[model samples]
Target: MNFESDRIWLYAGEDTITNRGVLVKVKEVLKPRRLRFGWFSKTGWSWLFGSIIGVFLEDFIEGIIKETWLVIVVGIAFGLIFVVWVFWAMNIQTKRYSLIILKRRHEQESFWKRNKDKIIVALIASLISGILGVGGTLLIQLLTKM
Candidate 1:
C-alpha cells in the first residue's frame, strides 16, 4: 500500500459505509491484525526527520521569546534567525532522507526497527534541548535582575 500521495486518506471503523478515502474490511475471524497509516517508507522517514527538527526549533523559539523581555530588537533578530535556520535545516533533512530512502528498500516493520535507535536518540536530544532552553532562559532572567 503506497500512501505517498496527498490525496491519500485513511479510515478504520466498524461501520462499513463511510465516505472516507479507502475502506478496508476486517473480519472478526482475524484476531491480530495491525492497521497502519502513512507508512510509505520515504514519506515516513521524511516526516520523522521533520518532526524531530520541529521539536528543537520550537524549543529555540521559546527560549528567544523568553529573552524578548530584555530586548525587543534582539528577540526579533533571533526569531528571524530561527525562521531561516528552520528552512535551511528542513531542506537539508529532506535531501538527506531522500538519499537514504533511495539506497534501501525494506519492509515497513524492518525499516522502523532499523531506525528505532536513531528515533530514540532524536527524542532524547529534543527533550534535553527543551529543558536546556527553558532552564537557560530562567537562569539568564534571574541573573539579569541581579
Candidate 2:
C-alpha cells in the first residue's frame, strides 16, 4: 500500500514459524457504485423487478379505477413493496461483498488510495516551519547583539 503501483500486490497471511506470506493478485478492483450490473447480475434484479411490477400495476390501476384517492392508496402500497425488495437485494449484496473483502485480509483503511498530494503538502509544511524557526532564532540573535 505504501508502495506506488497501478496494480498493488496483496499479501495474505504469514506463518510465524516460516515467516512466509502468500502474494495474492487482485483480479479486478472496483468502486462499489462503479461495479457493473450486467444483464446477468443479481445485484439489481430486485430493482428491475420492482420497476416492471410498477409498470404493470400502474396500467392495471388506470384500467380498473378512475378515482384519484384509490390510485394514490394503491401507489403507496406498491411503493412499500418496492422498498422491501430493494432492501432485500442490497442486504444480499452487502453480505456477499463483505465476505469476499474480509477474505482478502485487508483493513478498511487499506483501500484508501495513495496520492502524492498528501506527501507533498506535508513536506512543504514541515520545510516552511523549519525555515521559520531558524529565521526567528537568527532574528533574536541579531536583536540581542544590537
Candidate 3:
C-alpha cells in the first residue's frame, strides 16, 4: 500500500448551512469557537421565537392548554427532542470521523460501533444547556415584554 495514499486531507469547501463561511472538511469540526458561535446563533433565534410565541399565545388561544403543567410537559418534551437530536448529530459526527480514518485504511463500515454512549452523553449535555439557557432567557424576555 502506498503510504502517501493513506492520508486524510482537510480542505475548505462550500458550507451546506451557510454561504459565507468556508467549510472545514476534517474528521470533525471540533473547534470550540466555531461550536460556540453556532450555539449562540441557534439559541438567539430560539429565544426570539419563544418570546414571540409567549407573547402571542394568549392572544391567539382561548384558554386552550393553559395549565402550567401542560406548558411544562411541552417544554420537557421539546427538551427531550432537542437532546435526542443532538445525540444523533454527535453520533453522525463520530461516524463521519471514523469513516475518514477508515477511508485512509481502505476499510468499509458505515456505522461506528464504539463511542455511542459518549455521543449520547454529550448530546444530553447539549440538550440541557440549549433548552435551559435558551428557554430561560426567552421566558424572561417574553415575561418582560408582555
Candidate 4:
C-alpha cells in the first residue's frame, strides 16, 4: 500500500488481505491499531434509527403545520427551532462514537476538552446563521405582502 496526496493505492499482489486492486481517497490517514467492524455495524444501526426518527418527526411537524392556524412568523420560528433541535439531538447521539474513534488515534488527550472552545464557536456561528435565515424568510414574506 502506498499513500500520496491523501490518496491510497493498493498495488496488485502487494496487499495480501485483498489481492485485487483498490484505490481510495481520504481527508486524512490514521493507522488504526486494530480493526473493529462492529463500529461500522453500530453506525449503520444509528443511521437507520436516526432516519426513522427524523422521518416521524418531520411528518409530525408537517401535520402540526397543516392543522394549525399559525402566522407566517410563528411558523418560521417553529421550523427553525425544530431544525436546530433535531440537528442538536442527532449530533449528541453520534458524537460519542466519533470521540471513541478519535480517542483510538489520540489517546493522550481528551477530544472534547481540547476542542470545547472551537465547538462553542461553531455552535454560535450556526445559531447566527439560523437566525439570519429566519430573518431573511420573514423579510421576503413582508416584501411579498406589500
Q: What digit string (tens of lDDT, one per residue) describes model 3 on residues 1-146?
A: 11121233444455455533333433233232133333332345556656765675564353345656665565656556556655554554444332123253245443445667788999999999999999999999999998
- State TM-scores per candidate: 0.30, 0.28, 0.26, 0.32
TM-score quality measure for candidate 4: 0.32
Spell out the clash pairs found in candidate 1. Answer: none
Estimate, for each residue in 1-146, the C-alpha lDDT of model 2 and write its tens digit.
Answer: 32211223444465443433222222333323233432323645666876777687866577457667766676767778777766755654554342235343364444335556787888999999999999999999999999
* Candidate 4 per-residue lDDT over residues 36-143, each given as its tens digit: 332433345556656755655655567576775354445556557656655655554445232124334456567789899999999999999999999999999999
Off by over 4 Å in 2: 1-41, 53-67, 96-146
Top TM-score model: 4
Kindly provide the TM-score of model 3 when superposed on the true structure, using C-alpha atoms: 0.26
CA RMSD of each candidate after superposition: 16.3, 18.2, 17.0, 12.3
Worst 10 residues of 1 by lDDT: 26-35
The best-first sequence of candidates by TM-score reads 4, 1, 2, 3
Taking the tens digit of each residue's C-alpha lDDT, what string does model 1 give over 89-117? 55544543211122324444575687999
Model 2 deviation from the true structure expressed as Cα RMSD, one decimal place: 18.2
In terms of lDDT, the best-performing candidate is 2
Clash pairs (backbone) in predicted model 3: none
Please report, in order, the local distance difference test score of every candidate based on alpha carbons.
Answer: 0.53, 0.57, 0.52, 0.56
